[model samples]
Target chain A: MKPTNILFTCAGRRNYLINYFKEALNNEGLIIATDMSANAPALADADIAITVPSIYDENYISTIKDICLQHKVTAVISLNDLELPLLAKHKSNFNNIGVKVLISNEDVIDIAFDKWKFYQFLMKEKLTTPKTFIHIDEAIAETENNTLSYPLILKPRWGSSSIGIETVDTKEELILVHKLLLIKLKKTILYKASEKEINTAILIQEKIKGSEYGLDILNDFNGNYYGTFAREKLAMRSGETDKAISVITPEILAIGEKISLLLRHSGNLDCDIFIAENKIYILEFNPRFGGGYPFSHEAGINTAAIYIAWLKNEKIKASFNNYKSNITFAKCDRLLKIKSNS
Target chain B: MKPTNILFTCAGRRNYLINYFKEALNNEGLIIATDMSANAPALADADIAITVPSIYDENYISTIKDICLQHKVTAVISLNDLELPLLAKHKSNFNNIGVKVLISNEDVIDIAFDKWKFYQFLMKEKLTTPKTFIHIDEAIAETENNTLSYPLILKPRWGSSSIGIETVDTKEELILVHKLLLIKLKKTILYKASEKEINTAILIQEKIKGSEYGLDILNDFNGNYYGTFAREKLAMRSGETDKAISVITPEILAIGEKISLLLRHSGNLDCDIFIAENKIYILEFNPRFGGGYPFSHEAGINTAAIYIAWLKNEKIKASFNNYKSNITFAKCDRLLKIKSNS
Candidate 1:
C-alpha cells in the first residue's frame, strides 16, 4: 500500500489533532507539522516538526511547497484561521505538486474570515443573523430611529483573535469605544488586512443574549456534504469552548445541510450559531478545524480516521457514520516538554 | 500504614495535581476532590468527587470537616486563591478531626491574597517591589512629582482572577479607567471581599516591563523551607504562563529562600517576580497550588510526589532533590469526558 503522508500547517497548539492523526496513521504514514515558532506545543507531538516562515512572508508558499516535495506529502491541512485564506488562494500550487490542500475556495474563505461579508452572505441566503453595520453613521441613525438599541458589540471586521472586542451599554460609551477601537485596530496584526477597507473595518453588531452552539460541518474531499455535528456551548474561557455537549436536532441538521449545499467548503468548517426565542441565528464560520473540534471528536465522530481513509481512496461511507449526541467534554490544560533549541 | 487519603478543595481545573497524587499514592490512598460545581474538570480525575457549598456559606467549613472525618483525609490542599484564606481560618477545625490542612496561617494568606497587603509585607521585609498606591490621588501626585511615569497598571486590590486589569498610557486614560474599574469591581466576585474597602478597592502601580519569572517556593509540612524551583516565563496567554524554561540562579534562589523563610507558608506557594536592569522585583504571591505548578513538575521537581511522601510521614528530602535547570515546557489543552448528571 502507498503511504498517505500528511502535512499540517500553522499547527500552533493543536497537539490533540496531531496525536489523533498519528494514531489513525497507525504506522502507515507520517505526520509533519509546521509553524512560525519552533516552540509551539503541537510540534513536539508530530512525527516530524518543521519551523517555517510566517504565512505573510513573501516566500512562505514556496517554503511550504519545498517541504511537501521533500517529504512526499499526500495531503495538506491548515489549522489556523489567518492561514486558511492563504492556502485557499494557492491551492492549485499544492495540487499541481500532487498534494491536495484541504481548504475551501477563495470566495468561501472570504465569506468566513470577513465579518461584514459573512453577515451579508447569511442575509442573502435567507438565514437568520443579527443586524450588523459597517458604518458608524448608519448604526447611529438606526439607534436614533428606535430600530436599534444599546448594548452593542464592536469588533474588527477581519479579526480572527478574540481580542479587540468592546461591549457598549450606552450611546456615549458606544461612540467613545468606537473611536478607541479604530485606533486600537491600527496597532493590531489585523491592521494589514483592514488597511484596504480602513474606514469600514469595524462592525457594530447587535449583542445577542442566548444559548450559543457550535457546528462542525464535514464534507468529503470532493466537496460533497457528509455530516454536521452540533454542540451547545455550556462554558467559555479565553474565547474558546471550555465545556460543551453534543446536540443533534432536525432544525440544526437542516441548517447544516443548507450551508453545506450553499458553501460547499471542503473538509471541515467550524461554525457558530445562536438560538434565541426558538430562532437560530448564524454568527460566523471558519473554513478549517477550530478549538471546538475536540469536543465533537471526543463525543463519537472520528474525522481524523475518516480523513485517513479518504486519503487512501477507500470506501468510507459506512465505516465513518458513528456520530452520537448528548456526550459532553471539558477542556483542561496539560504540559508538554519542549526542546529548547528546536 | 493507615490510608493517607488526600482531599483537594476548590479543585476547579488542576487535573494534573489529582493525577499526580493518585500516581504517588499507587493504591496506598484515595484522592478525593471537592468543588462547588460538580462539573469541574478536576473532579472527574479524582477517586472520589464531592460538591460542596460556597466557601462563604456558614456551613462550608462544617461540610469540609465532615468530608475529612468520613474519608479519613490525611491532608487537605487547596487550589484556589479565594479559598486559601477560608481554609487557613478553619484549619484548626480540620485538625481536631485529625486532618492536616496544607495551608499557611491567616496572616500569610492575608498578605498573599490582598495586593495592598502583599506590597506592605514586601516593603516590611525589605524585598524589592514596585511602587504601589491604594489611592488614585497619591498615584497622581507621584506621577506629577516625576517619581512615577505613564503606562501604569490598574487592577483590583483583592482580585484573584486576571480579568479586571487595565493599562493606561496617559493621564486622561488613567483617570477614566480608574473610574470604570471601580464600577467594574462591584460586578465581579471580588466585590464581596472588597466590600469593607470599597472606597479604596483599586490599586494603581508602576507597570514593570521585563523578563517575568515564576517560582514554586516549597515548605515542608512543618512550615520549613525545603527547596525553590524557578522558571523564566517565555510567553503568556490569558494571564497564565504558556511557555517557560527552568532557570536556577543564585539571585533567584536567594529571593525564593528569603520569601520562604519570612512567610513560612505551608506546602506550595506560587510567587511571581520580574528582573529589569539586574534588579529583582517581587510582584505578588499566591499561597496555594497555581497554574504554573505543572511546568515545575514536568521540568524535574516532583512536588506532587514530595507532598505524598510528606503526607505518608516518609523521608522525602533525599529523594526529591533531583531538580535540574534549562528544561522547557508549554501548556496545552486536553479534553476530559463529563457525565451529564455530574
Candidate 2:
C-alpha cells in the first residue's frame, strides 16, 4: 500500500498530537509537522520538521502550500483552534493539489472563535444558556431601565481563557470597570484610542454561579456523536481548565449529544456547561481539541483516535458508555529559566 | 475651522462610498482615500488618494501607519469588508501615532467573515434557518445513513456571490459533483498545493425553495438598533443582489429586530431571510453593508447617514418605517469602450 503523506500544523509544541499521531499510524505513512518556532518539541517526534510563518499571515498559506507540494502531502491537520480558519480557507487550495484538508468551511471556524456569537447561536436554537448581552452599554441600559440584578459578568465578545473577564455589582463599578478595560485595550490591543474608539463594546451576562463542567466529544462529518466524556474542573486559571477529573454523568453526556446533533459538528469539540439550580446551561463550544483534552483521552475516551480513524475511513466503535469514568487527571506547567554567564 | 484629517483605507474607486461620505460631511473633514489601484474611482472625489499594498499584507499596515503619522490623520475608516480585519489588527499601531480606527476588535471581523459558524450560532440560539452542512462528504454520508431528502444545494462556505453553487438530486449525481469539485479545486487553488497552499472549505445544504428578502440595520455601541429597512431582492447573481427594492414588511422587520436583539450587532449588517411555506428562515448575515445598499438610500432609507450618525453618537430617527413597499429599484452596469484613434 502507498504511504499517506500527512501534514500537521502545530502551535509551539503539542506532545499530545505528536504521540497520538505516532500511535495511530498503523499504516506506513509519514507525519510532517510545521510550527512558527524552530524549537517546537513536536519536531523531535515528527518525520519531517519545518519552520513556518504565523498562521494569521497570508504568507503562511503560501509557505504550507510549498511544503505540501514538495512532500506530496495527502492530508492537512491543524492542532490549534486559531489555525482552523486558515486551514479551512485553504482547504480548496489543497483539494486542487489533490491534498485533503480535515476541515469544514471558513464560516464554521469564525463561529467557533467568538464566544458571544456561539452563545447567540445557542439562544437561536432555543438551547438553555445563561442570559447574555453583546454590548456592555446595552447591559447598562437594561439595568437602568429596570432593577434587581447585581454581580453580573463582563467579558470581551471574542476573548479566550478569560483574558478580560470581570464581575461587577453596581452601575458605578461597571462604569469604572469599563474605563479600566478601555485603557487596558488601548494599551494591549488598540495602543491609544480617541474617545470614540474607547467606547468599543463588551459582553455582559447574568453570571451563573455553580459548578462548571466541561464535556469533550468527538463528532464525525455525518453528525455521529461519540466519545462523550464529562470532566469536573479541579483547578483553573484564566478560565482554562488547568487540572480536571473525568466524571460519569449521563445528564451531561445527553446534553453533549443534543448539542452535537444540533451543530452537526465534525472533529473534536469541548463544551462548557454550568450546573446551577439543578439545570445545565451551556456556556460555549470550542470546536477544536483543547489543552486539557489529554485528560479525556486518559479516561479512555480516545478522542484523537476517533478523529484519526474518521479521517482515514476506518471503522470506529460506536459507543463510549463502557469507558471508565471518575478518574482524576492532573496537568501542570512551570516556566523554565537558565542563568546567563557573563 | 481647519478640516479634520480623515483617512479612508482600502477603498477602491467605488463612488457610492465617496458620495455617501460627501453627503454625510456636515462638519468639514479632508477625506484622504487609499487604494492599491491608482485609477480607483474614489480618487476623483478625494482631496488626496494614494495607492498602497493590499491590506492583508503586513507591509500595507506598516505603510498606512506611516502615512497616517505623516499626514496627522485623525480618524481611519474602511470602505471595504476585507480591509476591516486588517484595520482592526493595526488599530494599536494607529493609536501609538494618535489615530483612531472606526472598528471594534480584530476578533469581531474574524467572526463576520465566516458564514457557517454564523449559522451554527443561529442554530445555537434556536433561530430558524435553512438546514445546512459543512462538508459534502459529511452531507453525502449523512444522507446515505439517515435517508435524508434530495435536491440539496452546495456552495463554498466563505465565498462571496453564487460561485460554485449547484443543486443535486441523486446519490450518483452527488458523487459525480463531488469528484468534479475535487478536480476543479485542485486545478485552480491547489496549483500551489503540490507546491502546499490550502484555501476555503465547501458547504452542502438542503435547498430552501422560496422567496428571499434582505434587511439592513444600523446599531450603535450602545446596542441601539436603528435604520431598520427591509428589501426584497428583485434580481440576484450568485449571492449578490444585482437589483433590489425597499419594501416595508412588519414580519421581516420583526425578524431583523429579533436578530439584532440577539446578536446585539453593532455597526451595519444585512440579514438575508428566506420565506418558504409561510415561514421565515434566516439564510445568513453580513456584518458590513450590502453591495446593493445604495438602492435603499435612493428609496429614502439613508443607511450611510444613520451609520455616520451612530459613529458620531448623534440622535438618529427611525426613518425606515416610512419607506413605501413595492418601490422597484434596479441596478445595471454597461461596459464603456473608447476608441484610441479618435
Candidate 3:
C-alpha cells in the first residue's frame, strides 16, 4: 500500500494547509491533525483531530507517537517552527515506529534556528546577506569605518512571530533600541518557544532596501533540492505577507536553490530573501511551511502534491518552479465554524 | 523576420484576448484590432484600432486587405465565427498579399458554420451527438420509435448568440416552438450576424442531460491537432459561461484529438461538449476563441503563447492537453476606464 496517511502535529490555525493537502490527496489519504487546544480551527476540517499536550510537556513526544500509531500515519509534518527542533531531535524515534517525520537534520536546523549562525552559513555558501552583528561595539565600528551605517533592524536571534523586534534610523536610535530589546527579550526570550529561554540573544543587521520575497523551497525526503518559488511582497500585515505577486526572477530562484543544496532541508522550507541593487540576498529560514505557501499554491505550484509524491517515492517533475507567473493575490480572513469547546 | 504582427479582424468585446496576446508578444510583435463599431472595447486596448465595413459590404474584403497591408501585419485572424468562413473562403486572397490569415480550410469552416452540417460530420466521425431531425415527420417518427423525444431544443441552423432558440417539453410544445422559431428567424435571421441573412434555417435536437463543457482545441499553423483543454460550466450568463472549473477527462481530450486530426483547423478552435449519461457528446463548434479561453489560459494552458510559437515556426509543447486540473474560477464584471465616447 502507498503511504497515504498525513498527520500534522501542532496544526493550530493552518486550515488552508490541511485543505491543500486534502485536495492533493484527493480523498486517497486521511488527514490527521493535532493541537494543544481542541478549539483550534485548523483541526476542525481534518479527517481526525485530537488534542495533545503542549509542546514543552514531557509527554508530548509519546503523545504524538501514540496518535500516529492509532491513526496509521505514514507521513508526519508540522506547521509550528518550535515543533521542528523537537521533531528533528526525535526524528529517529518516529522513524523506528514507521512514521516518517519530514524535517531536516539537527545541524541544518541549528543554523536555521539562529540568526548569527544563518548569516555565517549564507556567507559560507557564497551568498550575500545584510551585514549582521551581535555586539553593539562591532556594529558601531562598522558604521565608523563607513562599511555599514544606521537604519538597522534589531530582532531576537531566532524569535518567531516578530517578537522583540525594533528598527532604528540613527546612531543614537540604534544604540537605544538595541539596548531596549536586550533588556526586554531577556525578561523571557522564547527562542522558538519550545526550546530554552535565551538572554542577550539578539540580531542587528543593516537594513537593505528593495523588494522582499518569500520562497517555498522543496526538497526530497533525503534533503535534495527539488524546486523553489518566489513571491514579491506587495503588502504586509502584522509582520506577515498580506498581498504579494509571483515573480520570475532567475537570481532569486538560483539563490534559493543554492541555499537548499547547501542546507539540505527535507520537504518544504520557508525562506526569506531580499532583492536589492540588482542582486539577491539571503535572510531568515524557517524549515517548514510559512505564511506564503497559499500564494504559491494558488499560482498553480502544488507543493502539497509534490510532498505527497516524494513521500510515496513517485517521480515528480524536475522542477516545481515551472509555473505560469504574474499573478497577484491577497490574504483574506477565513472563518471555520466549530464547537466552542470541541 | 518572424510573424511579429498580429491582426484581429471583426474583433468585438474580447479585451482579455487582446491583453493575452500583448503579454505573449512581449514587445516583440504588434497587436492590431478592428471592428465594425468604433466603440468596441477590445479594439480600444489594441496597439491599432480600425473601423472596418460590415461583412456584407461590397468593400469589406478590400478594406481588411488594406488594413493588413498598411500595418505590415504578418498574421491575420478573426474573433467572429461568421468571419471565419469568409476568411477561409478568401484565404488565398490574403495569402497572395503576403499575409497569413489563420483559418481552417473551406470544408472545415463549412461544417463548423452550419449546425445541420456539423451533425452530419459528427455522425461521419463516429462521435456521439444529440439526435437531430430537420423534418417534422422524421422527429415525430423518432419520438414514436422511442429513439428520441422531448424536451427538445429548437434553434436556427447556424445561429450565433443563440438568437432564435426555444426549449419545448411536449410534442405540442415542440411543434409550436418550432413553428414560432421558423417564422421568427425567417423575418430577420442574422445567423452569425457577420454573414449573409439566411432563410428556412431551423434545427430540432434532443436535449441531452448532464454537465456542459467548453473546449479550447489547439492546432498547428499547418492544421494539425496539438491538444485540447476542457472546462465544465458551473454557471452561465447571457449565453456565456460566467463560472467554470477545469476538468481533466482523457476520453474527452482524446475525442477532441480525433476530431481535430479529422478536421485540422489551424490555431485556436472553441468547441462545446456535453457530458450526458457518462458519455461525451459534441455540440456547437466555433472556429475561434470562445468565452472559455480565459478559463483555460488561467489554468496555465497558454494558447496565445502556443499560437505565437506555431506562427514563429517554434516547436511547442508536445501536447497542450497536459495541465493540472480541478481549478475553479468565476468571472466578474471588470470596469475599463475609457473615454465617454472616443
Note each model's CA RMSD in angstroms: 2.1, 26.2, 22.0
* lDDT tens readout by residue for model 1, A81-192: 8888888889997899899998899999989888998998889889999999999999999999999988899888984854547777777667766765666566564436
Pick the winner on lDDT between candidates 1 and 3: 1
Ranking by TM-score: 1, 3, 2
As a whole number from 0 to 100, the lDDT of residue B101 in candidate 1 is 90
Compose the digit string of candidate 2's lDDT tens values, residues B1-342: 544566777665345656666666655666788888554545556777788887556698889888887777777877676666667677787878778776556555555555677677778888888778766667778787875678887665552422356667777666555544444444444223122322335556777888878877666645567657777775664346645656877777788788777766556676788889988888876666666566566667766555555555567667532565555554322111111111
List pairs with backbone clashes in candidate 3.
none
lDDT of 1 at B131: 93
Q: Candidate 2: where is the Cα deviation over 4 Å? A: A144-148, A159-162, A186-200, A317-322, A334-342, B1-342
Scored against the native two-chain complex, candidate 2 gets a DockQ of 0.01
DockQ per model, Cα: 0.69, 0.01, 0.01
Q: What is the CAPRI rating of model 2's predicted complex?
A: incorrect
By lDDT rank, best first, the candidates go 1, 3, 2
When 1 and 3 are scored with TM-score, the better candidate is 1
Summarize candidate 3's per-residue lDDT along B136-243 as a digit string, tens digits: 778878888998877888777873733535666667666655554554454455555323534336678899899999998888878877788888887664467666
lDDT, candidate 1, residue A11?
Answer: 94
Give the TM-score (vs. native) of candidate 1.
0.95
Q: Top model by DockQ, which number?
A: 1
